[model samples]
Target chain A: MAAGNEEISLPASARRLLPPFAAAPFGPLLTLSLRSLARRRPGLFERLGEHSTARFLIDPTDLSFAFSVVPDGASAVVRVTGKSGSAPSDVVIRGPLLTLLGVLDGTLDGDAMFFHRAIAVTGKTEAVVALRNAIEDAELRPSDLLGLRGVLARLADAGILGGLSAARHFAADAPVAKAGQA
Target chain B: MSGRMELVCPAGTPATLRAAVLAGADAVYCGFRDETNARNFPGLNFSPQEMAEGIRFAHGNGSKALVAINTFARAENTDLWRKAADTAAVCGADAVIAADIAVLDHMANNHPRTRLHLSVQAAAATPEAISFYAQAFGVRRVVLPRVLSVQEIAVLNRAIDVETEAFVFGGLCVMMEGRCHLSSYATGKSPNLNGVCSPPEAVSYVEDAEGTTARLAGFTIDRFGAGEPAGYPTLCKGRFTAGDKTGYLFEDPVSLNAGSMIVALKSAGVTALKIEGRQRGKGYVTEVVRAFRRAVDAAESGGDPVEIDGILAGLSEGGRQTTGAYRKTWR
Candidate 1:
């Protein structure tokens, strides 16, 4: 297992090619929102059950970075990195950002995506299965998962989501943005 | 001909139920979101509220809904299964497909008007077993296990008075449906007990440059090469090495495509043709039910049902399909 604490130093040339989202505050905001959502619904963690400790790598193929999550139900941690880069994970789910969001929001059927081979899944299937079930069982949309409320929730569903729908247009070396309560 | 054989479809969720109904299924089978049914997978099955909605939807569309309370009841929680049957009856489901005697007894005694259809899990292929269930529980229909031949089914249907249902499509279980313990041995989950085989929590799939490998409980089920289609990793379909050759020891990763035999099955006195996969989604339900509806409708006039075979080829497991024991090609 690769250590999360292991230092990753990128050369100036390598750094130039990285996605700008990797340098933004979106990662920390995602982590905080996840923790807040866990507080809102501990059942999400309860659903993960035996796979609570497992690390999941959610790779949105349209985005250059991936989110690594350990939804421990309490103090859950979600981290976004430019690349997984061999950091060991219990499971890895790779698919289009829209599809991933659709699954997260309970709009897409995970089994159907799997059958159509729209998503590439690997590693500890138990955890992946549990995670997918947890998400769908909660029926949470991006607003819910992000703990976005009221007008912000509306923005999440429309403005932010609409912007993300065009995430492909974002610079390959984009920087992070946003922060939230954990 | 006894007219068009009923096209019984699987409805794993509320969405799938509507899809099946709109696609021309004569009937759709589903279960509560509990161990009372054989397809007790996570995020699958319906709530009582959902079940009511599904039943109403099916009814409005001229499709019947069959609730499956098929799993063998655990002694401690027998009432849970009974409650499911009662709920199904209250929801006015067309029938309850059940296997457990206690569940059957409860439905028979408590909800006398609720029709009973013996689930395949009961493995009641013999004349005596089928008759006993019918006599004791007033079982009106029986979903036959997948192991029997068409000839064997034709013979058995003659000895029985009730309607017979056969699995004409979807994933094949090599073992007697109710008797499989392979998943229990490996992952402590059994279809009859927990209503799962090679449960999602115990299965793994690793894809890499070498293609993909599926495993259950740390045991490798099968390894697929690049460009090869993958199937769900059930133990019965796993590849194993015997004395010399290494291959699928029990059965290959092939789907049971009995479309061509819709006429033969009707001739065998089969009342329904079941398309298994309650754990599947709306896309699968719509596509499969449509193809089968065409086949069953065509078979009404003794027309060939093979023309629609092309539509089903891509939907099969591992992109491979077989007639199973229907043709008895192995014999």
Candidate 2:
């Protein structure tokens, strides 16, 4: 269990190559994105939240960041919690970067990653399962974690963001993007 | 594809129902919003209002709408099943596709005029079981489980009086349709009971230096190597070490594409051809329904069935396909 508070200084060379806007507030961005998703598919989180007040600690092992996700009514609240050897969470998930990306893109089977030990989870199993179901029901993507589709699309049009533009095209052909409240 | 063979399609939502109907589905089947049907994933299925509207739309287009109340009723929660049936009848559904004997009995007694079609979840493969359902519940049709071959189906059809429906495409269940308890053993949820298999909640994926792994309830079901596509980690499709060799012990990650067997199934006296995957989206429903419509029509017209092999390949599980037990020489 890597401590969240462990000081991780990026290499100077890596820092120089990083995107200038990479330091943006992911916590607020993710919260706003979740709100947007909840708006599109109302009752998605509500059904998943059913009587459970779960706090999830998501650790992307390949990254230097971790976050806590708490479902609040129809939307989820995201916080960049400290790794200060804090109290155990209701659910904890640790997985590689590619694994997380694959799950988000619907290209990787989450269960398969767990089977191969590429992903790991602990604590209240039911709560974790519920959250996973809620997310899978959403058929989410990495871009969905940021509520900047219009900006990204514009950037894509100007050849500034190739990946986001490709995603724009993908969304056009994407299946009806919702699971029912039923 | 015989002139009399009905093409039964799946609908996960109201839009899909319309897509299926407009694509020439003779009949479309769907479930109530909850666990009353097998494809009970979140964000899928029709509400009572949606069900009524979808049925009305299908009926307006001269297509029949069947309501699936197919999951087994818990000992303490039979009312849910009963309510689903009553609602279906009120919605004027052409039939109620059911698996539970209690549900069948309730539908027969409470909504006598509402036709009952036995769900594949019943796993009623033999004439005796089919006859029992027909006699006990007046079930007019049975969606035969996926374990039977074309020859076996023809034989069973001859011995049974009820109309038989067989799967022609989509997800393939390795075990006897309703009898398998693999998911329950691994995840504490069964398709027969909860109407979910490899439930999304119980499923998780992890990645490490080795590769990606699929897990169910903490048990590793399968692992994918670098750049390899990962399939859903249902217990039956998982790779396991059997003896000294490791492989898909029960079945592979391929989906059932019985497109090539439309003529054989029709010749076997199958009253209907079922295309699975109600958990899918409208794009899937639209493409599959339209393609199968062409295939069924061609078969009925005594011409070559449409060449839709690659058309559905992208939509298949793990991007591969099989005929399943339809031509089971492996057995």
User: Largest lDDT belongs to which candidate?
Assistant: 1
Q: For all the predictions, what are the DockQ values?
A: 0.15, 0.08
> How well is each residue in A102-141 modelled by candidate 1, as lDDT tens digits?
5565444565556445566888776777676566446566
DockQ of 2: 0.08
lDDT of 1 at A155: 77
TM-score of candidate 1 chain B vs. the reference: 0.97
- Model 2 lDDT per residue over B93-189, tens place: 9999999999999999999999999999999999999999999999999998888999999999889988889998888886888899999998888
Give the alpha carbon lDDT tens digit for every residue of B269-311 in model 1.
Answer: 8988999888765656677898888888878866665475677
Interface RMSD of each: 9.2, 10.1
* Tens digits of lDDT, candidate 2, A1-182: 11111112222333333332452477787778777766766655653545236777877553445777777644578876543135356677875433454445444444444433455666555566555545544545444554446778455434523453344344334332111110
Q: Name the runs in model 1 displaced over 4 angstroms.
A: A1-55, A60-63, A68-80, A85-90, A95-118, A130-182, B207-209, B301-306
TM-score of every candidate relative to the true structure: 0.78, 0.73
Best by TM-score: 1
